[model samples]
Target: AQSVAQPEDQVNVAEGNPLTVKCTYSVSGNPYLFWYVQYPNRGLQFLLKYITGDNLVKGSYGFEAEFNKSQTSFHLKKPSALVSDSALYFCAVRITGGFKTIFGAGTRLFVKA
Candidate 1:
């Protein structure tokens, strides 16, 4: 079984500050991690993915995440937070050889302007 955990229910950041949303996972095999963002009532949007490559992966909208195998963590980061960046974020783990993808409950980011 594969699962992801986003410890924080909400992360608050002021405009122009750096923000980080933490996540950890448990999987049978190598983990395929992904980050997604959802605005208000919109659908989930793919932000970044950690497939098979460097530990550090960059994604859309100046977002990036580092895959830590030892720690079983993939934390999302943004150098400069924007008011528009405020959204509901999720961390997901793709079952190595299965069709199921488990996602964390979600973390709401509030970027105060």
Candidate 2:
């Protein structure tokens, strides 16, 4: 029983535009999606992972993510966005064999300049 749904809690991009942060998931097998970024107090930062092959997966700094396995969606892309890319974004799902990693209650990105 793995689950994640980040139905936008906050998102406002302006610095350079082109930024999307949204995710949805529910898993039983063949699902190990992940994307994380947190700054304020600093803890989570492992942005980008889909576990298998390119469904458009790239990470670190100039992030990217698009692994839509029939609408199980995993969307988090950044083409040009940096006001230090205002932080706090999380969408994760990894409980396949069980070591639990299910998180999505954060989506705060306000990159203004």
Candidate 3:
């Protein structure tokens, strides 16, 4: 079985500071990883994905993530946080042969100005 855990329910940070949203996963075989952001009443927007190759993958809005295969972790990172960055984030994973994707409960990012 494949699953994702987002330990933090929320992350608070001031604008211009670095921010991180932690994520860990358990899955069978290799996994396809993804990060998505959601605004109020809006569908999730794709932030980044880790299919293969690079361990460090960059995506929209100056966000990036590091895929640690050994630790079964993929943590999202940003050097500078923005007040507009305040939103909900979800970490998701899918097994190689699975059609269904599992998502973490979600982490609410609150960036203060």
Point to the candidate with the largest TM-score: 3
Ranking by lDDT: 3, 1, 2
Model 2 Cα lDDT, one tens digit per residue, 1-113: 67899999999989888999999999878888889898997799897798887899999988999998899999999989999989889999885567788898989999999
In lDDT terms, which candidate is top? 3
Candidate 1 error regions (>4 Å):
none
Task: Please provide the root mean square deviation of candidate 2 (C-alpha atoms, Å).
Answer: 10.7
- For model 3, residues 1-113, the per-residue Cα lDDT tens digits are 78899999999999999999999999988999999999999999999999999999999999999999999999999999999999999999999878889999999999999
The candidate, 2 or 3, that scores higher on TM-score is 3
* Candidate rank order under TM-score: 3, 1, 2
Please give, for residues 16-102, the per-residue lDDT of candidate 1 as tens digits: 999999999999998789999999889999999999879999999999999999899999999999999999999999976777889
Winner of 1 and 2 under TM-score: 1
Query: How do the predictions measure up, each by TM-score?
Result: 0.97, 0.33, 0.98
Report every candidate's CA lDDT.
0.96, 0.89, 0.97
Q: Candidate 1: lDDT of 57?
A: 99
